[model samples]
Target: MEGARGSESGKDPQHTSLDPFQVKDPNKLAINFAYMLEEVGKVAGTWARAREDAEPDAPVSGPISDLLNTFLQVSEYWRADQTRAIEAQTRLVSTFLDIWTNSIKQLGGEDEENPVRFEPARGDKRFNDPDWERHPFFRFLKQVYLATAQWAEEMVEQPDNVDEELRQKARFYVRLVMDAVSPSNFLLTNPVVVRETLASNGENLVRGMRMLAEDLAAGRGQLRLRQTDATRFTVGKNIAATRGKVVARNDLAEIIQYEPLTPTVYKRPLLIVPPWINKFYVLDLSPERSFVRWALEHGHTVFVVSWVNPNESHAEHGWEDYASKGIDFALKTVEECTGERKANVVGYCIGGTLLTASLAAMAQEGDDRVASATFMASQVDFKYSGDLKHFATEQQIAALESAMQARGYLDGLTMANVFNMLRSRDLIWPYVVNNYMRGKEPMPFDLLYWNSDSTRMTPANHVYYLRTFYLNNDLAEGRATLRGKRLSLADIKLPVYLISAAEDHISPARSVFEGARLFGGPVEFVMGGSGHIAGIINPPHANKYEFRTGGVTGGETFEQWRATANVTPGSWWPHWQSWLAAQDEERVAARTLDPHKTYLGDAPGTYVLARD
Candidate 1:
């Protein structure tokens, strides 16, 4: 049999003598275990403090609990079955028997091929350690895990077993469970963790325990797994470093006017409305990836809304306030600063939803300040909103609202946790194994750093958004309203450009494509080549991903639109720039900040700097 430890030589370590004492020194291990116990005590103290601070007898089912209940309800479809149960059991046992036969053959040094064939999906790096392949015990564990996970997914996908809604929820919840229980997450089963534990003489466990305690304390009893080195990036210094000035400030947002990088600029200014859930720096992270910098260089006067991180005082703020006091206020600021009656607008994620609704209201009022509109990974229709829709059920939202009521706002970390869970395998578990299991600090990453910087959402706005948008699907159904005015997407007549990432989870491309047909004016729908952030922030210089573009005019379905789209190489930034230019080819000398106007501060204003 192969040795437990990996070898430098190409030859298998099985030929070498293995000494347990060499792997771990007994004396050192004992001392480290004592240290680990001390950290465990500290961790307990943090948990106690958290319990005291937590709301007593909080709602029965917050988001996490609600999801678990959904999983349970959906799981009844399989649990109640007798024949299905026996079939599942038979398949599982057969796979295990095959794995056993293969392990025995490998142990006996037989050259014959065995029947057990199980491989992780491509891009799965959980079992990358060499021991997982070389060591018989570890190889057996890998096969068992893969087989079980595949069986679980198969159960969820069984024909006519459950409705689509339950099936989707079941699939999502099952994946989370499977990922959380992976052999790679535990010390005994993971080859890398075991190796590290032995090589460190258990010192790694001590350090890992200390980190666990510190993180628990940091999140006030909740685990705030650090995804990146937070100390590496600072807003307005390295991140969100685009040169600009805050020209206007309101209760909801600060309007920032970026300095021009070109000698000439377009006649109309550009206003960006980013989702308030995260800091605005995502668009301005480092010079190389900064979308704000790219737009400035392309001869566009850029103005972005930096939403105030809400607190108890802002709890009363709702969707109408966000549309009027946020986007509308920013539009008025753009005109005041540039002396242009009309300006171009871009909204990202939920920001785009607000912009779309407000645009319709503006149309009803005969307000045409916005010349053209662009949506970046934003959805107006919720029929195909993906797993996120699972959290918007009437019961779940009510429970979440109760939890938020005491605090007046939904904690930023709470919202962050939801987004993280959407891609838990990549966002949650890797960091778990790296930081807590291996006792190592994560590498400094600008995107993850920005992701960690989340902002609170007012309870009123959050509840209303969940109810009106996700639950009722009122926006797409033409029943959505703002400030007592019935809003309809078809009422907005401005030429619109819509871009959706092909792999976006929060706003699926299908949902975004469906939304494109609701517009009354000419619409351009483009599909970018990555998930939400990477797809939209893809600068042309990187030349990393491709995009598909075609005019969206008819009532064709998303699949038909995709079939007819023309694939273009490289980033969609250039295409958007060309589209913007085509709106009006007129140009003028680049304008400087109005010295006579009252200014709040530099770009990336005070609101984005407000942390939880």
Candidate 2:
């Protein structure tokens, strides 16, 4: 093993100085391998035991069957065209030959342009290691994998005779398959993992397997891939640390009134409605990045809805319950605290969707308590929505509903996995490598910690949301209803500010732009850089990403509006603050939640702390 640590001259099979597998001790490696196998057996045993009493995975069956059927359809379509099938086969064979020829040329010390050349997509970190390009063995592996992946994608694309929907699903599933089988994901194929495995004398595998077993146990026989150091940060103490008191509490949510930071505050209080899919802390991550703290400092009375991490008892809750029991209750609480009849409201993601519907419903009753509305990274029109739409088909939604009905609610882990699958390469695979393959824990990240802290969705609410919003496209089409009253976005005739991120896969920018037009009042649409979370949590101090603003007039396409929009550097928070100020400039003496009022708890509240 010591002699195998050769110089970086590329003469030895173990080219790097760290390679320890050349003269490995068979007994030591065998012991470690035995321990790993034992751990894996433990994981499997735990899973089998869990299955004894566990409800069948309702949500997974539909999507899995759908994916399989899509591939079957593609396979039939490909086979139907003999010429095309033969061509695809020939192309794949030619690519393999090219790789072989290139390997031969490199072995003979011949300088020649390779017949096959491929580069990993920009920002793909899997192949960033120098050895991937410098070492012949690793280089060949990377090229071969890339070539095969490209060929598979081409096969999916060429089957035009198949239904467009099936083709799209096929493309998506193929990508998932390719990402899973990438050379970087395997131990011997990935140069870095190979070195790590050798350097640790197989200890890495033992430790990694032990960690995997622990994770499986923690998730009750399911893999809850650890994204960050969960033990490092407590909710109220470190992450959602903004000073506030939960002045109003109910079965669905707690309304928190933050401590005032200024002598005067906006007469119109600000109420924030966060999506129940996760906790409300994403906006209040830290003091520096806390949007709650920022609003307080800007002389606005901020009230946030911290939704309960629900359980089976709350299974009967629906969208109307969330609107009336959650937002309406919070709104009434804000009015009582600040003596303000009208308040500015902000919603994020699905929270925004609920707010829009609630406001429209309020308008029907002539309730004008909301002065202005701000939507961040949310969608009302699912027509232009992203890949998530693929999962919300009628068949899949029915399966999801049945699963939720059987369990009384949808598990947070199931929902989290569905969202993570959309960006599996970034959100899923990297963690697999670092946690299980490299035998390391992820560093403490507040955002990912918040992500990991998920909440269950009530069956009634989730089913209605998927069917009404995703499938039927009801909200934008004036067909959505709540609390026995039909609601329409056009009925909400208040100043509206809509902002979306350019790279947001959850809610596409075009979808947000299209939804913006549905508003009856003046709408200002802003496009920000980065994805959903980063773009929204962007603090002014970071000045990291730019945002574009344009007047959203009727009859203009999304492209047209973006083309003529005014670009501004830094966070959109300041711009949002300015727009909020314009809604109602009246300033009154700052108010805090009265200590005399029956308070539930601190800023984060108990609902956020609950975990399954």
TM-score of each: 0.95, 0.95
> Could you give candidate 1's per-residue lDDT for residues 1-612 as a string of tens digits?
342333444456653324422565878888888998999999999999898888522354565686678767766766788787788889889989988887777665554443577899999999887678877777889989999999989877874757888888878888988999999988888878887888898888888888899898988887888999999998889999998898888888898999999999999999999999898888899999999999999999999999999988998999989988898899888888888989999999999999999999999999999999999999999889987897788888887888788878888888888899899999999888888878999899899999999899998999999999899999999999887898889998899999999989899999999899888888999999999999998999999889999877577788888899999989999999999999987888998876676678988889998987
Candidate 2 versus the native: TM-score? 0.95
Q: Please name the candidate that would achieve the greatest lDDT relative to the true structure.
A: 1
Residues 1-612, model 2: lDDT tens digits: 011223443455443434433537767878888888898898889889878868756656788888887888888867888987788889888988887777666654455643567788889899998778666677788888899988888878876577776676788889888999999998888877777776666788878888888888888877888899999989899899988898889999999889999999988899999999989999899789898898899998999998988888998999989999998999999998888888999999999999999989899999999999999999999987887888988899988888888888888988888888988999999988888888888999999999998788999999999999988999998888888888878888899999999899999999999999888888889999999899899999998999999788888898898889999999999999888888779899989667777677888888998986
| Residue 164 in candidate 1, Cα distance off native in Å | 1.3
How well does model 1 score by local distance difference test? 0.87
RMSD (CA, Å), candidate 2 to true, equals 3.1
Candidate 2 lDDT: 0.86
Q: Give the TM-score of candidate 1.
A: 0.95
Candidate 2: minimum summed lDDT over ten consecutive residues — where?
A: 1-10
